[model samples]
Target: MKRICSIYKSPRKREMYLYVDKREALSRVPEGLLSVFGPPQHVFDLLLTPERTLAREDIHKVLANLEQQGYHLQMPPPEEEYIEHLPDELLRRNDPV
Candidate 1:
């Protein structure tokens, strides 16, 4: 087990960055770290929300627990651009004819 040197998270960007020293052995990866995407959605929501305020240690615990639970942590795809519903006339006018 390697001690994490630092964890960087950019909420606006919605990501968690883990940094460990090169010397630490990282052979055993946490399980829940990757499987948090299923039925119990709150965990996944908490992870992705930009308002995360957990203490660093608490965050680490949560992540480690997630990994142990076989939850795989994945950087979800970039959020798709929101498309507003425009009236047909407006869309038509905006379109090049």
Candidate 2:
């Protein structure tokens, strides 16, 4: 199915995005989620199809979520080389898993 999608960025979290059907807008998202998500910043609008490619999330999965849940939340990628940030003392105390 073809759908016109609107993407919204989360003001509280960088790189976090919310995709929803443009026609329905945010109406389908629950109020509780909106509270934690803070205010949504409009990102961009696009026409979605099963074969469309997204920069991060799988387009097929995104489409399925939009159809079933009426919205899809794209979380930010984990910090790169996060282990490097750990204190040397902590790294030395633990065995590599």
Candidate 3:
């Protein structure tokens, strides 16, 4: 099936996004979900298909959720290891007791 979708970003979180039918828009998202998701920022509109590939999500799953629940939530990517970003001296000093 082919669907025209609108994607929205979370103002409060990076790399977080929401996708829904363009015609329905925000009306279909749950209030509790919106409460924590914060206000929606329009990202872009796109056509979704089973064969389409998302940058960080499964196209089939996204489309399935959108079909079943009226929307799809894309969470932020997993954070890198804190130690990987820490200064060498900091990691060395905190290595072991």
Candidate 4:
């Protein structure tokens, strides 16, 4: 049976639900899976799963789609130093348990 998860976004009170297979759920969950609450990107990032590269082209495509649908999104934040790929030596030293 496929277990569906419903995440309630507080302060906003938005409910988002997704149905995924068990294997996918196991691989994608963070240690505190039930407590996670945020946008899709934030949620996935907290889970420490591999993130899809959200490149400039992807942003442009999204803008285009939104405009076509008559939706105007707020300006994107300026790019700051985002560390994605860390050196193995660093991971080894930081490893817990």
Top candidate on TM-score is 3
Error of 4 at 60 (Å): 16
Candidate 4 wrongly placed segments (more than 4 Å): 1-13, 37-97
Estimate, for each residue in 1-96, the C-alpha lDDT of model 3 and write its tens digit. Answer: 999999999998898999999999988899999998999999899999998898999999999999899999999988788766679868789888
TM-score of each: 0.26, 0.84, 0.85, 0.18
Per-structure clash totals for the candidates: 15, 0, 0, 0
RMSD of each: 11.2, 4.2, 3.0, 16.5
lDDT of 2 by residue, 1-77 (tens): 89999999999999989999999999999999899889999999999998788899999999999999999999999
Query: Which 10 residues in a row give candidate 1 its minimum summed lDDT?
Result: 37-46
**Candidate 3 ranges with C-alpha deviation above 4 Å:** 82-97
| Model 1 regions more than 4 Å off | 1-5, 8-25, 30-61, 66-77, 83-97
Q: What does candidate 4's lDDT look like per residue over 21-78, in tens digits?
A: 2234433434343344333322321111123223332434433433343221223345
Q: What TM-score does candidate 4 get on C-alpha atoms?
A: 0.18
Q: lDDT (CA) for every model shown?
A: 0.37, 0.92, 0.92, 0.32
Better of 1 and 4 by TM-score: 1
Give the distance in Å from residue 86's predicted Cα in candidate 4 to where it truly belongs: 48
Global local distance difference test of model 2: 0.92
